[model samples]
Structures are given as structure tokens and as C-alpha cells.
Target: MHLNYAHATRFNPPCPPSQYAGIGLGPRMKSAERFAGHRQDLARKVHEAGIKNPQVLQAIATVPRHSFVDAGLHARAYEDSALPIGHQQTISKPSVVARMIELLHKNKQPLGKVLEIGTGCGYQAAVLSLLAQEVYSIERVRALHDLARTKLRPFRIANLRLIYGDGIRGLPQAAPFDGIILAAAGLGVPDPLLDQLAIGGRLIAPVSKSETEQQLLLIERVSSHRYQRTALDEVFFVPLQS
Candidate 1:
């Protein structure tokens, strides 16, 4: 069944001091404290908008978004807005991330191996690692790929792998993923990505419906050759490059 919904936009203020009491603080504790505080605030806002998946919400709270962006913008890390991550790409808004993942989770099965197109700064991949058993992320820009590798390494997210390549091509070696997500908007869903999804898998992305509008889309592979499409909230994302 095809479904479409208007985008619900909401933003909340930073978390209060009481919220950061128990988060550990050894070397990066100060930054960790800020992330904890802001992530809670972001999760609360995402939940208020109807994202009820506890795992998704917890992942949102646990991932340190500030680490994905430039240090100068760390102060705005938890503000529910996208931050530029160089190469003219931007980290996706926290709400959009939560919404897409929530929709994918509606598949009602464990997300085994997930494929992520556009691994900008590795923020989404980090979150996906928490939800799925393994995550394969592809980014086209070598600079961004290298940067994301460095940023994500310290986290020791062993289940996540970053690849520098053409994201539209998807990963054939890692085909049949249980879930696929794209960070950049494309004219339409790429066939390679569809072919890589397992029968019960779900792929979420932003597709350009017209020159002026792009809509969030969910594609679920029901059978070998049968798939269902659902159009969701209006969204803005960097265009996918070849």
C-alpha cells in the first residue's frame, strides 16, 4: 500500500543540567556530557512526533552526533538540525534519521545486514550499527570517506564498515541486505539498491518527485519481483553524485 504524509517539523531546546549527571566523564566526558544532554532532548522531540521504537530512540540518545561534525559546530550538535560535514555534504537532521529508521523498523523483523548509501561523516552508520547486526556504508567522496573513517574509528564500532565508492552502484558483494537507507536524494530509487535487498527487506530514501519537491520514500521488497512503495514526508537532501 502506498502511503504519503506531510512533514512534521519540530525543534527543542538543549537539555538541562540534571540530565547529564550519570554519563561517564574520563577524557572526553565533557563532550560526552553535552552529547548525552542533547541526544536526550533530540530523542524526546522525535518521540513526541510519534517515533515509538525504543531501540531507535535509544540509538539516537546513545550516538554522539557532535563527533560527526566539525568541532566548531559541536555546540549545535543536538539542535535537531543538519550540520555541514564538508565536501558540500551535510549530516542529516536527527528527526529525519529517526523517522526513516522508525519506518524501516515497521518491517517487524530484526535488521540483519543493512546497507547505507551516503555515509556522510558516519553519523547514520553509527546509529544503524546499534540497530542492525552489521552495517555496510558507502560514500563517494574520498575525503569525506577518510574523514568519516577517522571519526568513527575511536568509537570501535566493529559491526560497521565504511567504503569509498559510487553509492548508486550499491554493494554487490554484500547483496541481499535486510535494510537499506540513503542519505542523499536521488531522482528515483536506484535499481541496484533494489536488487540488493532481501525479499523481506525495506529501503528508505528521499526521491525527487519534481524539480521543486523531494519526498521521503519507503520501498519494501515483498517477493523476488514484487515491491511496495510508500511516499512520505517532504525532505531536502544533497543530490547523489555519480
Candidate 2:
């Protein structure tokens, strides 16, 4: 299910206006301020769930989860639960997302470039943008791809690039990523993704243990010919698809 270069379409959102451009006052600002407390509370919950990285917790508190979901689901946005994002996909729970990202940050080194295999609603990509210097996210579902693009555009994340393609193939042209995170569960880590990891890089994903069970898996490239794999946390995620 690997897609060639022609099948992948890159979609980079327009840059946002400057923060100091006198755009902070208004109804939007007030609404965002209103959600600030909720975001903070969500971060605290994620922290309690065992995500020890302070930067990851800060990112959890900074990204407005409410904005990534529909207006009707806003009430539950900050809760540590997954929400439907159409196309039979659900946004990963806040605690799960935090945990995975924290695992990627296990080495305590700033990420250079990261790849995200699922961009449902672009929520995780937004959080990745805050941690990674560059982020390339691939989504196989065309509708979800467009949905994520639309939802993410308003935020104007400059470092994030959305692509509509087969994530199982991994982005070869952009190989040697410092970190890779997959939002879906599969039988195992795709070989292409493993090959794309740079030496000293880390990848976090969920591997299916059974039809109804999954466990978080971490792979770290220790050398050109060596990789270390570890299994952690029981979890559930939508199946990874090409």
C-alpha cells in the first residue's frame, strides 16, 4: 500500500499573523482565554497519567483541543477521552497522546524533524509542531486529510506540513527523521518507517495484540544496523490503513 511520489500531495497552511501585531483583543481572545483553564486542567490530568516531560505537558496545555473538535463536542474536548473525527476515526485521547510524545522525547534531546502517520483533525500534528522543528504528517483518507487541513489552517502552524498519502510507505524523500509517531494500531511497525528513522531516532506506535487489544511500542535506532524495541502501556487505536 505504498504510494509513489505522485500520489502524495503536500499541503502547507499559510503563515499566521504576528502575535505582537495587535491581534490579541476581541471575542476570539476572550474565548481562547476561557479555554485556557481547561487546557491547563487537561495537562494536569495527562501529567497524573504518567507523562513526566514538562515540555510535553506544556504543549498539552497550550494547544486548544476544543478547537480541533466540532462545536458540539467542545464540552468534552478537554476530557482525557477520544472523540470521533468522522471517517470512523477518533482523535487520540489526551493522556495517550501525551504519553506517546513523551516517549519520543525520552532521550531529552530536542527533535529535529518528526513524522506523524495519522493526522486526524490535525490535533496531534499541532502539538508536534510545538515540539519538533519540522513535522510531516501523512493521512491516507482523503476526506480526513482535507478535514485536518481545514481544521489546522486557522492555527497557521508554520512548521507543520500535511500530506495526503499512504503513511505505511513512510516519506522517503524526507528520510532520517528524528522522531516518528503513529496514531493508529497495526500488527507491527512498518519496515519503511523503521528504515526512515535516523540513527539515535525514536518511533512511538501502537501494535495490535489482538482484535480488541493494543500495546504501545517504541523503537529506537541505536546505530546504522541496530534498533531497540520496547513495549509499553495497554491502549486502543483505530487500525492503521493504507
Model 2 weakest lDDT span, ten residues long: 14-23
TM-score of each: 0.86, 0.89
Tell me the tens digit of each residue's lDDT in model 2 across 1-242.
Answer: 11111236443332222221111232245577788899999999998998889889988998889878999999999999999988899998999999999999865645678999998888998787777777789899989888887776665556667888899999888788999999999999999999999999999999999998999999999998899999999999999987
Candidate 1 segments exceeding 4 Å error = 1-31, 107-110
Give lDDT for model 1.
0.78
Residue pairs with backbone atoms closer than 3 Å in model 1 (clashes): none
Instruction: Give the Cα lDDT of each candidate.
Output: 0.78, 0.82
Which tens-of-lDDT digit does each residue in 62-132 have in candidate 1? 88888888889988888888889887999988989999998888745346888889888888887877777
- Report the C-alpha displacement of residue 51, candidate 1, in angstroms: 1.5
Runs off by more than 4 Å, candidate 2: 1-30, 107-109
